[model samples]
Target: MSPVRRQHVILRVVAKLLIPYILLFALYVQFHGDYGPGGGFQAGVIFGAAFVLYGLIFGLERAKAAAPPRIIEILVSLGVLLFAGVGVASMFKGGNFLDYGVLEHDPLAGQHLGILVIELGVGITVTAAMITLYFYFAGRGRA
Candidate 1:
């Protein structure tokens, strides 16, 4: 194969290998939300950024092949639904919207669960939305 195509293949292999670790770190951030700044928003961006970087380095077509728009759309909606669902649950449970303390018999546990869920939702939304935008911009750039 040509040097340019060979380089693409090499870069793709490296990116695929690193993608898993990046995703793992994002999960770690999601889980660590109970203690630190490494919560949903940061985690989501961090997660999406890896893929975006992959696209930039390899090709937008490769990125889109990796993460299609349909998938991103579904993920974005899921995140919003998850957030609203938790809020509605809190409302029904006699607390303000998103007050997770109502989720369990132990209000503190409920709070922790609620925070984790909502933080996850936030992370998903941020990641999906950012990815979708990245795709659009990258696609435009390609044109």
Candidate 2:
């Protein structure tokens, strides 16, 4: 009815349309890192940016509801575990820590798999951390 309400509707429509594309691009960066210059770090930042944009367009409460703090913490821990688990697995495979050559029957495949897993871990951690930071800062001084 009001101008503010109309603007809100438009904003919501635009965000809903854009979020999927943003997340898809992030995935591309994550999976295509081996061939290109982008990697987990870049992908994570892009993924996190999508959430941050959602928060900016919607509200902090909605963002928190979408990604709870507990889930974020768990993702952070799991990312670390995933990264470290690769190293541990290599050790058990009779290779030095982070030695990807032992991850599979073929050394090249092993290295590729190892890099993918580690990059995934990195992406998870960075994405969670960035979202968590935004939640905390946005919620600061609130009742």
Candidate 3:
């Protein structure tokens, strides 16, 4: 192993322990955002932080391996599509743009569903964008 890796054994171990919990908390925040004090953007940042922590400790190359740039790019586009698609779907369903009330047989259920999906799209986009930025900036000025 390289000297740097050998020197950061403690950091690597701690990161391993913390990363899972961070991801779990992200999920909790994501699903619970509608009812409580959390949401897609927050969860996305937290999710991105886990990978950022991994990169800081393990090296950028390893982090990229864990989450490739291509996949992250795809997710960014996909997330936007998902979000916009929801709005378009609502239009098709005979409602105004993003009219969640038209999303289901019942307005309440449709509201729940629309919010959930929209939040998910936001989370995915933010997470991917964060990772992409990290990869771009980190890869710069490197040999």
Candidate 4:
């Protein structure tokens, strides 16, 4: 254990308790985004914040172990691909790019599905990007 972890036992315990709830809240914000005020961006930030908090309380190495940089990079690309894939799929369905109306037999269902998928992509991208940024900045002075 590092000096910070050893010194801040209470903080570590508190963080352990809060991190799960934070992640859960992020999920709620993500799924409920379309009908409510929150959305992918908000959920992504919240999710990233949980990992950041874990990094702060525990240590950067441990956090990195939990969420590897390579995986994060892959997620960033995967999210963009997923977003664009949806648009392309819509086009293949005989609609304009990102035209969710043609995604399904029922236009309303297509719209719902499109929004859900795109928002999920946004959330993944944002979450991964945020963690990558944190890793970059936090690890900068170390090596």
Q: Write candidate 3's Cα lDDT for 45-101 as tens digits.
A: 999999999988988889999998899999999988999999999999999999999
lDDT (Cα, tens digit) per residue for candidate 4, span 73-122: 99999889999999999999999999999999999999999999999999
lDDT of 1 by residue, 9-50 (tens): 777788779988998988898889779769999999988988
Ordered from best to worst TM-score, the candidate numbers read: 4, 3, 2, 1
The global C-alpha lDDT for each of the candidates, from Candidate 1 onward, is 0.87, 0.92, 0.94, 0.95
Off by over 4 Å in 1: 1-5, 8-14
Identify the leading candidate in terms of TM-score.
4
lDDT of 3: 0.94
TM-score of each: 0.85, 0.92, 0.96, 0.97
The digit string of per-residue lDDT tens for model 2 on 1-143 reads 33454478878899999999999999999999999988889999999999999887887778888988899989988988999999999999999999999999999999999999999999999999999899889889674
Candidate 2 global Cα RMSD: 2.3
Clashing pairs in 3: none
Question: For model 4, what is the error of residue 123's alpha carbon versus the real structure, in angstroms, after optimal superposition?
Answer: 0.3
Model 3 misplaced stretches (Cα beyond 4 Å): none
Preferred candidate (lDDT higher): 2 or 3: 3
Which has the higher lDDT value, candidate number 1 or candidate number 2? 2
The TM-score of predicted model 4 comes to 0.97
lDDT of candidate 2 vs native?
0.92
Candidate 1 — what's its lDDT?
A: 0.87
Candidate 2 regions with alpha-carbon error over 4 angstroms = 1-6
Top-scoring candidate (lDDT): 4
